[model samples]
Target: MERKYFDCLIQAIDLINDGIHIVDRSGKIVYYNAAAKRLDEIDVDKAIGRHILEVYPSLTFDTSTLIKVLNTGNPIFNIEQNFINYKGDKISTINSTLPIIYNNKIVGAMEVSRNITEVRVLSEKIINLQRELYETNNTSVEKIKKPKAHYTFIDIIGQSKEMLKLKTLGLKAAMSDSPVMVCGNTGTGKELFVQSIHNSSNRKNKPFIAQNCAALPSNLLESILFGSVKGSFTGAENRPGLFELANNGTLFLDEINSMPLELQAKLLRVLQDGRIRRVGSSNTIDVDVRIISAINIDLNEVIESKQLRQDLFYRLNVITLIIPDLSKRKEDISILIDYFIKKYNDKCKKFFNGVSKEVLDIFMDYSWPGNVRELEHAIESAISLYDGDIIREEHLPFQFKNFHPTKNFTLDTNVIQPLNTAVEKVEKEIITSALEQTDYNISKAAKIINVPRQTLQYKIKKLDIPFK
Candidate 1:
């Protein structure tokens, strides 16, 4: 039965996509799975029972993670390693090596490796091509045309006091060369503010490059941001990172909280002295770029969770600008709606004067979790579906249907009531509709209306609404 179990485990390990290699404490290869054979381009019969150094001549005792684990009885995880196999071919892999202990004694070590040679090669090629294009364009033209920032302060649409204050602060931040941090919820046009800052800054004529930190993995993102030297890793070529490309202008890093902590330390060094070293190179290059980073969530929460390094945050947060959510700035709803309507009308070539009273009331009452972007999309969708002179509740998106006003309150302009009474009535109606739609499930109802569950519960009690 023990032999059967061992065979079953071996079969499972052999079928996996990652290479598995096990070595005894003496460093003899005991098990080399099929994936290991393919990744190293070695024959199974030649690898098994041979010393690790004999199988891969390029690996030394100090350089091999597997051998280190065996000697130290410590584990090493997710480390990128580049080495030459017995076939004299360069290989790159992310390897995690673990020590196998039996009866409180280290018996063997096993390594699981995911091949990333192709991915590394392809990414390097892309960087090289981009560098070639940049150099060609710059040298070919007498008047070099740098990347432009399309938006300016005037393009920002808002009249609310909060927005006005934010814009004023943004303009001030633009004047300084300090690293600025923009905080706002998703879809609040963080990029718009970023571009506006760059266009208004002293380095406006230089390149303005933007990269979302969450868009790529740690390894790829590191290479793309810091660049790589030829032979740094297998298939790596000379290439410049975003820092070099945006040397004289701005490097806008969106979702900065998503960057890896190790990389953040590297970034902190750059921010400290304006110097950066490409991957696998000892040479340091000076950069004159200003960094403008943006995060979608609360600052304190990410710092507490350790998703972002506090030291790096402090360096980048020298000039912090927090944009208010749409719900907090309700006064701008009508203005934003009108702007979106006119803007879409010109684009769609449809004449949409404005939304009807019922639609307007619903728009004002609904919680826009997606913020201004959502409102614009809702208007555009309504315009596309209906070719009427004015948009009505029926023309709006399906989400707005849950916010239809109750019959007790008339939406007519002639009907007047106290503001508090009218607001309470509308809130009750919308909450009740969300509850019914979610079958009395408070969590689901809150999610449908895009409010916190606790807030929904408080509203339920305040409004005296019944639920199962």
Candidate 2:
């Protein structure tokens, strides 16, 4: 490489946010970037040219990702490593180590590491705080009277056929101790159903803990769910995870599809036998906890993509409840709007009657990709902006204003159609609207409309609708 180009590459590497540590074939550190210096809390001059074990004495040749890659001439990606640096500060990082190969011979090894120590510490603190709060609340008689789950079946506002059926099924599922899986699009009130089930179940009085699997990385999530024992890894402490905290209660794991496959296997093991072993602990503890997991995508597709494990799906999916999209159940839109209007009226201290006919028409014609949550937000936004007795089109959000109805049906009194014809026309209109909102993507449109992709495809072909 040219001198100028090599210097430019070095400067660019230093500019990256992730720590870059490059070592020679002999396991001697050759280059350390600025990020590496900051992450390791070591001077660049002190790190460069030093042996990898010299700087990070906690790591051995067998354990060090960089040395292992150099020895095996193989790449290791997204592996979490916890070690105590030479400064005696314990640090955690997710590293991707790759061998530098030139002309079929391994020349060196480079490891790009992202510092997650702060994130792990913050997560642990949050868990500890939650434990403290739970203990305090349990000790006080007055605080113990508080409800773990505030919502119930009565809290669900929809009256559409799909929603009514879902509520009925939910009540039945709540009667049993079986695992239930709630699947729906984002903002479709999956948590509402989960909470309602908990409140209606025998474990209503016990803790109703919920965690978003997508919120944390695999290692942190594993610790959070299964607890951790001291000396398990660097900086680990003896702590109870959600499984123990929510004992004799319900543990709702949202976005279960985002959980790592290996973690999912552990979860499946716990579900199979009501036994959980804390992270780094060999002894198993028996816990009676109901699992209610939620996913916001197609289960079949996720299983096919290997994002979700098939066996875990079968285990948790003993009773599956699919939440319909807002667009699919337009019959409930008016009632939901009325409900939100009254809610905001009391909240904003305004005596707003309702939305205008124009606004309602626009809402009815619009496809709500964000589902019921989006509708509530839109109503809240309009109410906050409008001081009038009724909400007008001008008070609505920009998206509502920009939306143009692309329906194939028309209100023609002169041309009367049969019931089946009218139903087909409406179905085509709804499918088309969803498709347009999703930019002609069939799979996404199917999800938005709460229909199977194959069914949507068949409908598209049968209706002679144009799709990409």
lDDT of 2 by residue, 91-118 (tens): 9999899999999999999999999999
Candidate No. with top TM-score: 2
> Candidate 2: where is the Cα deviation over 4 Å?
86-88, 135-145, 406-468
TM-scores of the candidates are 0.77, 0.86
Candidate 1: residue 217 Cα off by (Å): 4.5
Instruction: Give all candidates' CA lDDT scores.
Output: 0.85, 0.87
Q: Count of backbone clashes for each model?
A: 0, 0
Best by lDDT: 2
